[model samples]
Target chain A: SAVISQKPSRDICQRGTSLTIQCQVDSQVTMMFWYRQQPGQSLTLIATANQGSEATYESGFVIDKFPISRPNLTFSTLTVSNMSPEDSSIYLCSVAGQGVGTQYFGPGTRLLVL
Target chain B: AQRVTQPEKLLSVFKGAPVELKCNYSYSGSPELFWYVQYSRQRLQLLLRHISRESIKGFTADLNKGETSFHLKKPFAQEEDSAMYYCALRGTGGYSTLTFGKGTMLLVSP
Candidate 1:
């Protein structure tokens, strides 16, 4: 398992504002995943960020709405643009382990839109 | 398409009682099941994975391909065992993406 951390563990932002959540991993990883868990809801995949390539977004996620930057193997950023109340959720970043089907999660960034 | 289902939102049990957290998944390819636990104010950590077929912190989950289920079990409950348990599934392949369940809140009463 890798040690992962997220910045701005919890934040309150006004509507239409944007917040960028940063994820840092202790070791280099080939794949970084972003997930959002809404209040009382299941975790949903937002995107997969791979270094040196544009992120691959999930079905309901888009680059324009949730932009991602995989600047390097150990870091990635997810920026929620034009945020609204519905966008409030706990955003988490995770990294896959060396073994297949294994993943470790970060502490998660809790976002609240006012 | 892949999905994990945890039917119980909350499961309350008295200390020393047996505990079981039900999980079911749907996937076209070979499925791998995992149980993750998040204690209060703690990051989510892996409790058990079907591939390992091993127990951690007194918890074990058996993968029943026939029923499409992978329910977590513990012979005896401890107060410290209380936490949010999430069942996750990853399809067989190069893809490492995971589909997580809604999570079940386990409350072990002393």
Candidate 2:
């Protein structure tokens, strides 16, 4: 498993503001993903962070709302733009490990939109 | 689309009793399944994977393609095993993002 760390473990932000969450891995990984878990809901895929390219978002997600930056193999950032109370959730980052389907996740960023 | 289904929202069991967490999947391609666990105040972690075919922490799961199920089981439950368990499925690819089911909160009482 990879050791992953996320910055701003938690933060409360005002609605319409944006907050950027950072994820760093101890070693370079081939894949990195961002997920969100809303209150009483399962984890939802936000997007897949691709190095040197725009992230590929899921059907219900858009880059304009959640912009992702993968500057390198070991680091990525996800910004929740124009946040709302509905966006209050725990955002997590995960990296693919050496084995197939082994995804080690970082401690999630708890975002509370006020 | 690949999807995982964990029917039980919560499972309560007594220590030393048997435990089983049901998981089902809907996928057309070959499925890679995983069981993830999260302790209170801790990050999510992989408990085991179907491909490994190995028991972890006294827990074991067998994939049944015909049934499309991978149920986690343990002969004896422990109080410390109480936590949230998630079943995930990955599409056949190099870096396919995992599709997770609604987690089952296991509560093992002494």
Interface RMSD of each: 0.9, 0.9
Which numbered prediction scores highest in TM-score against the true structure?
1
lDDT of 2 by residue, A1-114 (tens): 689999999999999999999999999886899999999889998988878878889889999999999999999999999999999999999987777777889999999999
Q: Give, for candidate 2 chain B, the lowest lDDT window spanning 10 residues.
A: B90-99
Query: Candidate 2 regions off by >4 Å?
Result: none
Q: Report the CA-based lDDT of candidate 1 relative to the real structure.
A: 0.93
Count backbone overlaps in model 1: 0
TM-score of each: 0.97, 0.96
lDDT of 2 by residue, B23-108 (tens): 99999988899999999998999999999999999999999999999999999999999999999998655566789999999999
Q: How much of the real interface does each model capture, measured as fnat? A: 0.79, 0.74
lDDT of each: 0.93, 0.93
TM-score of chain B of each: 0.96, 0.97
Predictions in order: chain A TM-score: 0.98, 0.97
lDDT of 1 by residue, A1-114 (tens): 799999989999999999999999999999999999999998898988999999988899999999999999999999999999999999999998876667889999999999
